[model samples]
Target: MLQRKLAALLILLPSSLSLTVTAQQQTPSNPVAPSQLALALPATASLSTEESHKPAFESSSAEGVIRITPAPQLEKELPSQRPFRTAAFGIKANTLGAGAELATPLFGRFNLRSGVNFLAFAYPFGIDGVNYNANLHFKSSQSTLDWFPGGHAFHISPGILYSKNTVSSAATVPAGQNFTLGDQSFINSVGDPVHGNMSLAYPRTLSPMLLLGFGNILPRNSRRLSVPMEFGVAYTGAATINVNLTGTACTNDGCTSFGGNSEVQASLTQEIHKINEDLKKVPVYPILSLGVAYHF
Candidate 1:
């Protein structure tokens, strides 16, 4: 019995000592480092390693969650930096005749056109034996500044051509018929018949143009119809002729008074100085057009 009691006491003592040692060892040795478990989390469950690799239906607004993000795309304007947005209206023909035009857009590729043209006619002729009756008028007006270049439809213009062309005539010489002036030769007095009047003018009524074109009546995408064509020159100068005669003429030494003939007014001033030296060798005036346009 004594031995059994001693054994129990020793066992109890050992058990108590063991329990104390175990408690001391359970505190912590070295397993908690993900930066110490993210500092024991809870600053809203702290997560950073790039928010634990984002996109878990990514949210924000402090988790009241609201972030859609997909609107921001507006920047489009480059038809040569558009200007005067759009405008075009046209109708045309050529050689300064039937026309009506108006175009706008004056920036970048540049444009600005304007127009007006008209024509009138009536002619019936015979020159020398003189029996004319002509009347031709062609009014005009223009304004331009096109230049396309790289935005090409090919163009280049620079203009201003305002004219009111004319050519009037009304002459007859049938009483004994026969005529000629500078070189002198005439007849037509019987009952006085050799009345005359002639005119042709354009001493200069604004002209200074230069063009070269090929389609493009304000066209910068979204086409709204176009068809334009041009070729030009206009420096209108020298074109003036005027002649007037009353009646009575016949020379083989007889009737006279082509206004009291001083040799028929010096052969009508040498036939108006040889018809103004052949219209000063044409001082430009030739343009060609063709069109149909509409835009807005």
Candidate 2:
């Protein structure tokens, strides 16, 4: 029994030694170094230094914080859009007579306007004491600073009116025709035909104008055209009348072409007095105007 057992051990020992040699020849995929095994972890389960610093995406299974970065947008590089700033226009009986103006946007919700106007009209009339054929004329330049208190669509305008207001007249002591002086009618200065040239002017060339207006003649935000309306008062000073006489006045002899008679002078003075009374009723003029404007 002992001899048989010794032979069996010899055969198994050789086989076991051969298997050990084969395992040593092949390299281990998960070899453990001193540092890797220090934390009591398997070598195959350990992380590299770089891998340890990386953020983990697996929720709950990993312990780490992640950061996200956004890309830039192209729209932010585009230019900004803006509104209209200036305009030109033709205006009616407002600041300037019948003329034109230019408007420009000033600071916030304000507009500055400048322009000139001219107008002339003729009329035939007979007052109880006066005979007259006259032309009324107005020529002026104006400027305004407008404030849009409500909106750009409505405005309060205070302006400067620089104007020449006049009335040119021709009158004659009606030969056979009755002439009205004021309340007095004169067929002739004493009894002969008399002729005179008359002109009326305002003492002030500059006046104050205030108006409440509507419509954005030149619009900043709207794309359409606009029509504006303005109504106001112009404070024109007292009227001055000038009269020049020629040809026949009251004379002891009769009506003559050139008469320096005291009667002639007295007649002229009376006529002037009557005319002055007629002007006293008006001092402030009413202003109304309509305008169309376009912007670019």
Candidate 3:
């Protein structure tokens, strides 16, 4: 009876142990805590590549934001350079007026002249018979060619001039009678007796002249007054083709031939006679003048 009881108790203990092991294997493990999940999340990502490409600056308490690069500055240029200059020219004024250019180098090589001039002169009266007076009026239009030849000291100008001179006279005749007379009585040895005569004289003249001159310059600048001495010769002749006068005269010396009568010599009466006087024209002559010149 004791042996059987011990064996039954051992078998029952073994079965109970097996049952406890199986129950523990079927149970699930505990879930993780919410706080631990929050800690495991990735930190915020660094600035992206797109953001890094843009301009960037650092903010700080000690220094304000500083620009990393400045905008391109506009280029400046100076004005194009050129030389400064003043313009100039030469002009002259003279006695000849604005047109009257004294031969000077200011107006390049050529010169022009224009003006009015007055001439008053007297020449010896060529004849002895009567009284004579002469007056000349000169009007001129001219152009000149100047030759430098060397210095400004000298020049030559060839030109033309037109002029007029008037000559007039009056004479007293001696009182006398011709003996070729008995009713005709007024005749003498010479064509007519000049013993007593009175008459008026007239001479009118016109002349065209070719002139050439030589001058000596003292010294002057353009627009200044200068002294120049000029001498010129002119060939001039009257416009009238034939300028001649001829006349007959008779003179008696108190001797008479009255039919050869001799009665107390008849007061010594003279016979009438015939005489002739010839006056010729003067063809060409020379003229001289002196004057000053001005330049403006």
Cα lDDT tens digits, model 1, 1-296, are 99999999998998999998998799776679788797777655543444566666666442344446667899877452366665789998988789998888888788888889998888888666767788889999999999888886899999889888998988778888778888989888878787878888887889899999887877777777888889988999878787788888888987888887687988877887887899889988888888898876
TM-score of each: 0.39, 0.63, 0.36
Instruction: Name model 2 segments beyond 4 Å from true.
Output: 1-85, 93-96, 180-185, 189-192, 249-259
Model 3: residues with Cα > 4 Å off, grouped in runs: 1-108, 120-128, 171-223, 238-250, 253-285
Candidates 1 and 2 compared: the better one by lDDT is: 1
lDDT of 3 by residue, 1-296 (tens): 78898999888988988887776767545545787765654332222333455465532222233345657899542111111111112222322222222333323322333233344444333222312233333333333444434445566555554334333232222234233211233333343323221222223222334333344222223333444434444345322211112223233435333234353123222111111122223334444434455432
Worst 10 residues of 2 by lDDT: 76-85
TM-score of 2: 0.63
Which lDDT value does model 2 have at 183?
Answer: 38
Q: After aligning candidate 1 to the native by TM-score, how far in Å is the CA of 166 from where it should be? A: 3.1
lDDT of 2 by residue, 188-283 (tens): 554446776788888789998888898765565645467888888778865867777666532335454434655555656776776676776677
Candidate that scores best on TM-score: 2
lDDT: which candidate is best?
A: 1
Return the lDDT, model 2, position 197. Answer: 74
Alpha carbon lDDT at 279, candidate 1: 85
Clash number for every model? 0, 5, 35
lDDT-based ranking, best first? 1, 2, 3
